[model samples]
Target: MPRGAVRVDLNISLDGYATTTDQTPENPFGHDWGRLVGAYTATRTFRARVLGDTSGAGTTGVDEAYAEAYFEEVGAEIMGAGMFGLHDHGDDPDWRGWWGENPPFHVPVFVLTHTPHPTLEMEGGTTFRFVDTDIEHALELAHEAAGGKDVRIGGGPTTVRQFLAAGLVDRLHVAIAPILLGRGIRLWDDLRGLEAGYDVVAETADSGTIHLTFRRE
Candidate 1:
């Protein structure tokens, strides 16, 4: 079988910003975070997988289709320290993550951080492994843990940008929310003409969010 592909799923604003500076100690995610991923989190797939809501209470349209694809065929995940809630909770050694006891990822999760922490095996099949190394080494470990399934480059924007800059990503999916967040980390800052080698597709969801998918040629 072919080695699983490297993928990234992210939510950005109309201006291409992926992060905001308004995040306070009280609200780690900041105020505009929800607006960015509102359409995505409202999908049935997200409700069932992330929110653990099985009552079938969410949209099942274009956005849902991408949301469903996000979880499918992913065997291992790689995320930044902030994505794992490390930037804010680093002081707390027992702080598992933002997802509580059982995270949504039911696979090996490689967290890119500077510190060396013990492997945290969570409730589901998910196990958190911190990699205090380069991106290539992290990808190697993730691919090994994936066991032939796809390796996901889970985001915090900066992490995703690194993979994209290194040209290691196979498939890139971004849900473009309509909200205008004037101040934040822009996703397309220096990565101009990134759509050159990829087959791109754009679809507007019922919720006005545009889903853009880029598959390497």
Candidate 2:
């Protein structure tokens, strides 16, 4: 049997920003975050998986195709502290996650942070495990939890960048939303000449979202 591959998928803007700074108390995710991930969320796959809308609605084109692949063959996921809402509500012991009763990721999700928290088991097969260890150790734990399936590096850009910089990712996929955010966390900041390590491919969707994929050669 083959071991699982470490993969990552993210949504970015044309200006290379992966996150925005317009977050407020009422709108925690920021308004632009929706615009950034608008295309993927509009897909039928996202509707069925995340929103539980099995009405057979939504587009089934390139965007949907990538959305479908996002959940394929993955048994475990690793995310950053920010991705788990720890940065905002770390003190709230009752704060589970942004996903509510049940998160879309049914697999085990390991959250990397400087602090540790108790494991949270949700309604579905999802289990949230906090890791205060390093990136490589987190991947090791995720791989074990995956049970032979692929391990996904699901993130908030910073975590993804660290993993990519350490040459830990086997596949990196980014959906470039056709908008320019002037200020935010940029994905390709210090990682110059990243293409030399991976075979890259790009595909444009009907929504004008360009899907860029980089696979280690």
Candidate 3:
């Protein structure tokens, strides 16, 4: 038993795009994907532990339960450089992360990047360590950081595709929103040659989102 379990939690459109065309400020995605993520992150227990806030009092049952499962079982996090944004460059060497002063992840976060950068120590015991190596190296570091817990693969599509192509991901949890993004970024772009099989372990629907969990089979 390693320190962590690799899991990917992401939101996609009905068309399978994780992001819409023109992600810039001028042409933001028309869908309310941010709202959906906000709702998911606002779970009472999740917010309390991750954000150090107790304002998320009225979270629904399913959302709270899902958040608990994600956060409680996670010991470390892995993400692509894109998901972490362009913090690697620019003048701010110690930019920490995009999650402002305190990121949601309270454990070690292994960021996959090409350039080498120093580890960022944020509030709430979150350390953002950049990894320029391949997926296998990143997974090994994440598992080491997890310390017998599970490693979560936070994504920006490309990173998830790499892991999937390498046959490294054990489980995937995708929240499908009821919208269509003509084109932007897709999750299954490079999965054509992989021998991955999935079993639908659970499925649920909310106001505007359908949650689907798959276990590698």
Q: Which candidate number has the best lDDT?
A: 2
Give the candidate order by descending lDDT.
Answer: 2, 1, 3
| 2 versus 3: better lDDT goes to | 2
In model 1, how large is the Cα lDDT of residue 17? 90
Q: Per-model C-alpha lDDT, please?
A: 0.91, 0.92, 0.75
Q: Per-residue CA lDDT of candidate 2, range 6-38, in tens?
A: 999999999999988889999988999999999
lDDT of 2: 0.92
In lDDT terms, how accurate is model 1?
0.91
Instruction: Report the C-alpha lDDT of model 3 over 1-217, residue by residue, as the tens digit.
Output: 6455579888787788887554457656433556436557656876777667867674767666776777667888998887787544435675656677678788899988877778888887789898889899889988988888889888888889888888888888887766777687888786774444777755564545677787867
User: Residue 100 lDDT in model 3?
Assistant: 75
Return model 2's CA RMSD, one decimal: 1.4
* Count of clashing pairs, candidate 3: 5
Q: How good is model 1 by TM-score?
A: 0.93
Backbone clash total, candidate 1:
0
Candidate 2 Cα misplacement greater than 4 A, ranges: 25-28
Better of 1 and 3 by lDDT: 1
Q: Write the per-residue lDDT of candidate 1 for residues 1-217, one digit (tens) a residue.
A: 4679999998999999988777888998788988898898899999988878989999998999999898889989999999898998898888888877888889999999997778899998889999999999999999998989999998888899999988999999999999889987888877888888999989999999999989999
TM-score to native of every candidate shown:
0.93, 0.95, 0.84
Alpha-carbon lDDT of model 3: 0.75
